[model samples]
Target: MTLDVSEADHQRVSEAIAVAETGTAGEIIAITAQTSDSYHDVGLHYAVAVLFFYLGTVAAWPPLLDWTWALLMGWSAPPSERAMLTLLLGVALAKFLFVLFVMKWMPLRLALTPGATKTRRVRRRAIMLFKAAAERRTEGRTGVLIYLSMGEHRAEIVGDAAITAVTTPETWGEAMAALIADVKDGRPADGIVAAIALIGEVLAHHFPRDAADRNEIPDKLIEL
Candidate 1:
């Protein structure tokens, strides 16, 4: 959604404004697209956790029965012999391994990459410019990731496939929806600047020119 900009709201975002970026100098789009894509994995993990709870507890009868038997068995072991250590370990391991796809590795798969969001030159421009503006970078061979930002709140994702111009309300909405969908589908923020430019074009027709933009030059892309 476009940044809400009532006078009071502007003041709030001006204060709360937070920008996030990732990837490397040459891999900004890859980083943003990846970051956008990560939300899905987070959601997937959330779902799997629910399923594990249900399957491990309610769906199976054997564990409950085993536990009941253990309780009935006389002096199975000293009460002190049992502890939550195993349960704690299992939870920690699960969190470290599965359900943390981004945590592990999902490589910066850029839209510029085949089968990426959109590979058209225009799309690539949007992705590149957006990342460049934000100064994204990939740290190294390791899967380590970072987000860098200056004074930005709204994010846009643009591509050649994106509408040529944000000339109308419907087009504006489409642009907004696309970025949100990218996040839903786990895309990146590389092209977001182009998308915002497109929106600015739309606003130009109806609203007064946006007050002077406050966004500053992004820091140089680095291994972050």
Candidate 2:
């Protein structure tokens, strides 16, 4: 899935972040990802399911296979055990290829993935990005990461330990809710800016900028 953010939108968000940070010592990082995971395991599980289903069908209706063989060979005789095994293997191979083709369509692959799995992957990715990009990098450890995965329709807000100590998760609820609402409405850039504004307000209230404060992290949004 394409992230709806444009170059203009990136500049706007960067400006918003720069403005937001001026009021506080807190450092904010915004990241958008096309997807958090490939979900290949989900596809593999689907293929395995198809294999089992075909096997069960063959077992339940052995005559169907015999009829297939007869049609192909133009003979009514029942196949030998070896021939029957070969036919089952061929069916399995066909099913595998068919599932591989189906898995190429991302929507179908994602649909086969469990909701819990998607949530776990999104959260894990957000945490990873937070650590790689912003964790403990700020002078006062007042760093926060706002992460969004477009394909997964998931968002996460992660605050550094110092910020987390002073602010409850509820402090971010309004910002996150607004961001998600905008994303669901196909206004991802608007959602991100709104969330940043709200975060800026909270940070300004809790960690107002001091004369010694300096920008420790870049303001531009990160896209993956």
Candidate 3:
């Protein structure tokens, strides 16, 4: 879900938020992030895995060790134990470095990352952002964050303590489903707008607008 988010899309989301907030005191904040995490640690883990797998292969196959030794030192006498150890270390290091370098590309790194890891990372980031930008920000403590992570093709809805007290995470299933559907079809902006409308409905029901209600969070889509 690479963000091709346009100004018109942003305007539509802003307008959707405004309309949603008109009927509720809940402050809705929408944010779209290119990625939730860099996953450099995951890359390092991958490199280490590759290194170990290579070592294991060499250890499991005596012929492979001989081949590697020959490749490193051609037509020479059988290497000493110290030389073999150095050769294994050197080759393993090269494999590790090569994998690490390849993982520098974002798409490849993300593709190789496990789905559960991506989901967890996306959710974690959504919560962190919600805490920073929306949680307990409104007068009624009814702030909701609609977070979209394009890199992971995932979305999350986080409500402030006031809203969460009356509703469970499952309450946002419809909105999340709509968002995932639209995102899968490459309509990220439309997905966000639709999700906002649905979330607005929930907020209006759970926490209706008050006479003195004021907007605490900006009603615009943030792109990162």
Candidate 4:
């Protein structure tokens, strides 16, 4: 799955960034991703849960195995202990595999992931991307990153050392709120633009532009 940010949307975000940086030496970078992690472990956990549930149900009801055995083998004679155990294992494996197959669909897999897990993964990914793309890259160490994960409907804002030294995470609360509100309304570009403007206001207050200030980062929205 991919974010539906069109070329026009990209241009809008780029312009927002350019305008935002005009008053501050700080560099602002924006990134959007379809998802942060595959959460394959979540899928494995689900498959195991289903497998155990099936086993528990069959254990509590032995006749279920008898009926299944009869339906499969069509035999009047009761199956041996070995046959019953084999049938149980086989059906449990089938159930597990069926669940695994269904979870291969990305939407279902993402939907099944816990909200806390999604939040953590998106934050972690945003941090990693910030470190690689924006952290300490500017002369004043005033770079900032705004990351959004479409699949999880989550966002994170990370600031470089200089910015963080003078401002707390709460400093970006209004910008974050603006971003989430517009994103939830299916206006990602608008959300980003609003966020950039708000962030610019904060940065300008703390790190006003100097006569020699330069654009340390490209003004664009990176799609990942």
Q: What would the per-residue lDDT of candidate 2 be over residues 1-224, giving only the tens digit for each residue?
A: 56578999999999999999999999999999989999988888888889888889888988878877877777856678998889879978899879978997898887778989999999999999999999989878899999999887789999998899998878899998999898888889999999999999999999999999999999999998
Error of 3 at 165 (Å): 0.6
**CA lDDT of every candidate:** 0.34, 0.90, 0.91, 0.93
Q: Let me know the TM-score candidate 2 reaches against the reference structure.
A: 0.92
Better of 3 and 4 by lDDT: 4
Ordered from best to worst lDDT, the candidate numbers read 4, 3, 2, 1
Residues 45-123 of candidate 1 have per-residue lDDT tens digits of: 5546654764465335535434533565654653232433343344445554454453333342221123333224334
TM-scores of the models, in the order given:
0.25, 0.92, 0.95, 0.95
Clashes of each: 21, 0, 0, 0
**TM-score of candidate 1 on Cα atoms, chains taken together:** 0.25
Ten-residue segment with the worst summed lDDT in candidate 3?
59-68
Cα deviation at 75, candidate 4, in Å, is 5.5
* Ranking 1 against 2 by lDDT, winner: 2
Task: Highest lDDT: give the candidate number.
Answer: 4
**RMSD in order of candidates:** 16.6, 1.7, 1.3, 1.3
- For residues 1-224, what per-residue lDDT tens digits would candidate 4 score against the true structure? 44589999999999999999999989999999989999999999999999999999998988998989989999778788998999999999999999999998889999999999999999999999999999879999999999999888899999999999999989999999999898888888999999999999999999999999999899999999
Error of 1 at 93 (Å): 5.8
Q: How many backbone clashes does candidate 2 have?
A: 0
Which runs of model 1 end up more than 4 angstroms from their true locations? 1-34, 37-60, 64-97, 101-103, 107-167, 172-224
Give the C-alpha lDDT of model 4: 0.93
Looking at model 2, residue 214 earns an lDDT score of: 94
- The ten-residue window of minimal lDDT in model 2 covers 70-79
